[model samples]
Target: MTDHPYNEMPRSDDNQSLFRPVAVGGRGLPGNLALAPMAGATDGVFRAICREQGASLTCTELVSARGIRHDPGWARSWRYLAITPAEQPVAIQLFGADPDDFDYAVRAVLEHPVLSSAFAIDINMVCPVPKVVGTGAGSALMRDLPLAARVIRSAVAAASGYEVPVTVKFRTGWDAATADTPAFARMAEQSGAAMLMVHARTRDMMYAGQADWSVIARVKAAVSVPVFGNGDVRDGPSAVAMLRETGADGAAIGRGALGNPWVFAHAAAALRGEAPLPPPDVAARAQTALREVRERAANLGEARGVRESRKSLLWYLHGTPRAAETRRRAAVVESLKEVERLLADWESSFFDKNGAVHFT
Candidate 1:
């Protein structure tokens, strides 16, 4: 449906394999490619970078239900809470299981001026992280359909007087043998979710094996609301295949966009019937990384901002020609000057000769 061009495009009913602007809170979201709410990764600065590079929608890292109540300033103080004016339509994701706690979490989120202005409220019901599931939230919700539905309904009620749309992200159930994405999708839609995001993997997998796109297809078949497939979408072709193979409404990219913010833009272009553009060259990527640090530091203070950004720098340089050496240098980088020095020397070898990224 979207005109973006990938290496291989699949044909289907016009309604079935296309990119349509999803409207939340009566606003039209641009690209079909949405960023996943990866914990400690999808912070506000990173979200802005990806959005600038062309992500249609972005989500905040998962926040705890209890954390919000305990720390009234949690959302306000989080680096991800500092969104730029341009990255509108982003969603803040929250995780928790207790019905009362869930309600309290919603109230906390609504208190933030920036958060309440979001296009949608995303409920994270599918995170596979042990710390998250251990508390009966995240993937643990898969085992209790009734409770999960209640949580969703409670969140929806919090927005009763508002127009903000409610969306849910979930996995393929607790395990491979017991995949229940279809059932969950039905429950989410029936309970009031305007959108459903399927991660295509089970809680047990936990980033192990490849995501089962077939499961995504099944969820899409079972749900009338838009179904965005997530998992293993590290490139334009993969994004295209996920759409084709699963007939998903869109994609929710996570690790893939870490070092490669261009993924969002390239994927958007590919989806729009154009040849994919290459990622920035080493020099350009390094410059972008530096700019990101500066921007984040400006907003979050220098010391903590640069320190919090170390992992992302390593991600961008991962798999470059001299990645091992680059990673070695990045790991030891304690200051912005050190980061700049490392990228200065490694730029030539790590970046493509012609400045095109080859994710292959």
Candidate 2:
């Protein structure tokens, strides 16, 4: 492991406590660990698994406010906003450039029977993708503070009537030269955001480069609202370091949580000043992967679910023996049965004459 201080395990006497409940408006999260909203990776099944695995809060993937306004029946957005009862305290994240669309979208969410019960309404200003940024939404809003304030005001106003909190997630700035996250935090808080989450990279950096935790620290100092630090938080120590270094109220795990829902459990343990559970063995990884595939199959039919699960299946097999070949076979799996056969064969190879797992 690298000698970075953040990557070092925390000691029992490290004054930096990582776990705590955060109050966001009328709702209260049981702990500070949250699953950051990811566009395609965090499906309903994965969200539920993360919740079960110890994520105190979860967020739906980014949904388009304009799409919600156009499809009031939720015909097109249901897949992204689908939150099961098991994933309670989930937030529905909406992204759009227009304040009017956010106003309508927040109202629409509050009116829906199932969605009305969400823990909070999260607004996305952190996504750095081209399509989203090209439309003056996502991180593009960072360049226009006035418009960003208006959008937050619109969402907060709409959700206030239902006693639901509004949260904003954003990058540090449009680029390194214009890094003004503290100012952005103040604007969001003044605009009535109940909570703020900072992904410490600039729009130009996208997902590359080291996230500057100093920005998150500045943001926490700038706003009274709870601040959650996201980016590069891969495990317990990094989560703790984010809290320790930034004084953030929480740590939000994004790519770190893919195929490894146990990250939440490990984070929780570290927050409690305890040793994290050992990493899952190959059997455990395969089992969880199968469970996710089965649940997805049950929800979205076998053919589609298995097809969609290809990437996740590959993630589960990462670092294992013959991973390249296994991933190659997994890439084109079109049915649940095919996945099962592939996993069974792959798993069996790990066993010896004694039926015990033996890694070479």
Candidate 3:
């Protein structure tokens, strides 16, 4: 069991084990749980924390091939792909429509000291953010299967020689209005995708509505490569249900992980058919958040760490009382002392809803 610091981690009995090792491109992932590459979230620090909590694999935030080609800041752009020895089995996810750029980017990444730690390469075909779609990247790739194939072939060619597998993550289609993922999945497999992840919703659906697991089922039927089901998976039961419903090799955890890394451990246990563990109580959450703040401060420095803490900090207190005011303070506070003060105030207020504290 991991040194969870708060709760007693559960053990997996052989009979109840829901997970077995999964192989991707000749590399075996310890388990099948993956962390989705959310743009503003899942940076190196957060990725390290989540991996420590149990996510078996993680991909970087989407890097733009065009940016890699023209921007002198390309080195800085690889920040999301930065890895420590502990964050192994990470993938470098890239986005763009230019096949040439895909080739150039992959080769360049294979040589970068910071990014050489990637275990695989993943192309993003599921982003719904208008900027990404308008540029004919992201979900736009879904509309042009031929262009998508070209991009994948280029990336695969560049990496296959090095034995680095390339994967793709995509949504069903533009929306519920059209679902073409089965055909798309077949094309990607033929194009040399080592694995695939289906988000189970259309690009137009964004993160809304229920993720249609039937689409994952369709994609799994369409290809021989491993398929991971994404979207709407919040915890252990949902993770197990995704694999069972679609016959997917595994499930990907996205928004469900905000402020809760333990979901990975719980999901792993739940896969084994164990009881779903209880959520962290207020004090436990407060303490964990405090530790994360220290990690952030040490890794990212006080100013940026404190500045960014507001979002994740608020996420930790998502449903608790006095959350609104704390969110406002967390948004701009600039010191570990300030963060500690806020956590201290919350601990005092955890049982006293009427209690209030003001930031200095």
Using TM-score as the measure, the top candidate is: 2
Clashing pairs in 2: none
Residue 225 in model 1: lDDT: 71
- What lDDT tens digits, residue by residue, belong to model 1 across residues 157-189? 886557677899998999877777788888998
Off by over 4 Å in 3: 1-16, 73-76, 351-360
Query: Candidate 2 lDDT (Cα, whole model)?
Result: 0.89
Predicted structure 3: lDDT: 0.83
Ten residues in a row with the worst lDDT in model 2?
1-10
Model 2 bad stretches (over 4 Å) = 1-16
lDDT of 2 by residue, 183-266 (tens): 998999999999999999999999999999999888887777888899999899998888887778889999999988999999
**Model 1 clash tally, residue pairs:** 13
Q: Give candidate 1 misplaced runs (Cα > 4 Å).
A: 1-17, 24-26, 75-77, 80-82, 348-360
Residue 61 in model 2: lDDT: 93
Going through the candidates in the order shown, the clash numbers are 13, 0, 3
For each candidate, give its TM-score against the true structure: 0.89, 0.94, 0.90
- Of 1 and 2, the candidate ranking higher by TM-score: 2
Q: Give lDDT per model, in order.
A: 0.78, 0.89, 0.83
